[model samples]
Target: MNASAAARHPYLSPDAPRVLAHRGLVTPDAAALGVAENSFAAVAEAHAAGVAYVESDCHLTADGAVVLFHDDDLRRVADDPRAIADVRVHELEEIMSERGGLITLAQALDAFPDVRFNLDVKAAAAAESVGRLVAPHAERVLVTSFSDARRREALAAARSAGAVRRPATSPGIDTAKRLVAARALRRTTRVRALLADLDALQLPERRGPIRVVTRGLVRDAHAAGVEVHVWTVNAEDDMERLLDLGVDGLVTDRADVALAVVNRRGTTAV
Candidate 1:
């Protein structure tokens, strides 16, 4: 574990380099045992592996239940041809029962009371409900979406629901793009302005050939009181390299492996 940085927010407290289980953990062994991503089992396994953070996407069912799921349609995780918005909560639960178990936003929060969640509001329709569900638990939840408008909508709803503390947030695609431009131009004031309301800069390491999480980018993000977290990194070498680059977090499918790497580095994250 790296030395703890100054706490930026409650969600980011004890600010050491950390690992966020991407969609929870579905290791090769777990997958072989019929586990599925974003299932309750996946998150349980990550928790069992001692990971403190989990990243997942949220969608709303037809009956207005917020579920931890990725795609709009069921074609990928479930072989069903229907859209999630067309299915009732119980029906979706039935489908997920065999594949590890359905994990609603509520259930995940309740079950993993000690873990922090980084939830992506995947659908515009699910945004408000996701916010409402996460409201009371706002201190441990981070609401985000690719659409800046959608992300803000959820945050607004959380406030409406009387969140005790504002949830942590990351920039959407547009804001991230603008931030990158500001960074490239060395506009110090503009960079801070762009990050004024954000807690983390969660991003891909690169966009095609354009590297997004460069040394300077990491430095600037840290200077602005935001932590930089790279997404979808699974390989051990990549994990090691990114940690060396001074990233604050790694969003990976292999939290188990990440923990091992972190341990090997002699920096166990609290």
Candidate 2:
């Protein structure tokens, strides 16, 4: 793909470098702030802090409602032994009521109408339902999963649910590995082939010290009109370094600090 064809999907913000709240900004010391990961309060906090994209994961409840949560069970917030899929949405909501309010997929979209969401389908069973829910709101969502099959299934479900425009998507683990191999071989054609319907390459800066987000990877991904977003980046220094390295976005638990780092230089580009 040529440079012009490498233009990103319109679904992504035009802002040169994006900052995304990973699981809605629940810090390691969240107890002090009384917010929990994937909680309504956490998302609200990110929104109040002026983050444009909030990254979250989805799982199914016993009643089959799709919810914005990261873990498979209630141990983190409620300390309950029940799995998320084993309990109904309302029950989980009640369990988390005092810690950080819980909200359904529909409720999250409705509550934060102005925000763009980067959703990860964490469960295979929730894939289709998640797709259907995000279909009408396709323009503002980017759906993904570590499981590539689940990722594609979710996208297909969204398309089947009357979405004229498919939601933006990031390549899952296997697809990303292919891109890595192509990058290693300096094969732009192969890289382009992998980005067919994808909008971005969202990845970690390093996978167990293997160092995934090299300058070449960023350049190649961008060359194919796909953006590169590094994940779970925290600390002001790392944020600045990744931005300096030309990553198109940062998925962080500290959007507050990341935003300040980017805007400090007044229109820093990645």
- TM-score of each candidate? 0.96, 0.94
In angstroms, give how far residue 39 of model 1 lies from its true place. Answer: 0.4
* Candidate 2 wrongly placed segments (more than 4 Å): 1-7, 27-30, 268-270
What TM value does model 2 have? 0.94
Which model scores highest in lDDT?
1
Per-residue lDDT over 1-270 for candidate 1, one digit per residue giving the tens place of the 0 to 100 score: 222444577888776778999999998987987788999999999999999999999999999998999999899887889999999989988998878899999999999999999999998999999989899989888989999999999999999999977799999999999999988898889988999899999999999999999998888877778889999899999999999999989999989999999889998763
Clashes of 1: 2
Q: What lDDT is reached at residue 150 by model 2? A: 98
Q: For candidate 2, write residues 74-171 as lDDT tens digits.
A: 88677788899999977887887876899788999999988899999998999999999999999899999999999999999999999988899998
User: Which candidate comes out best when scored by TM-score?
Assistant: 1
Backbone clash numbers for all candidates listed:
2, 1
Q: Give the TM-score of candidate 1.
A: 0.96
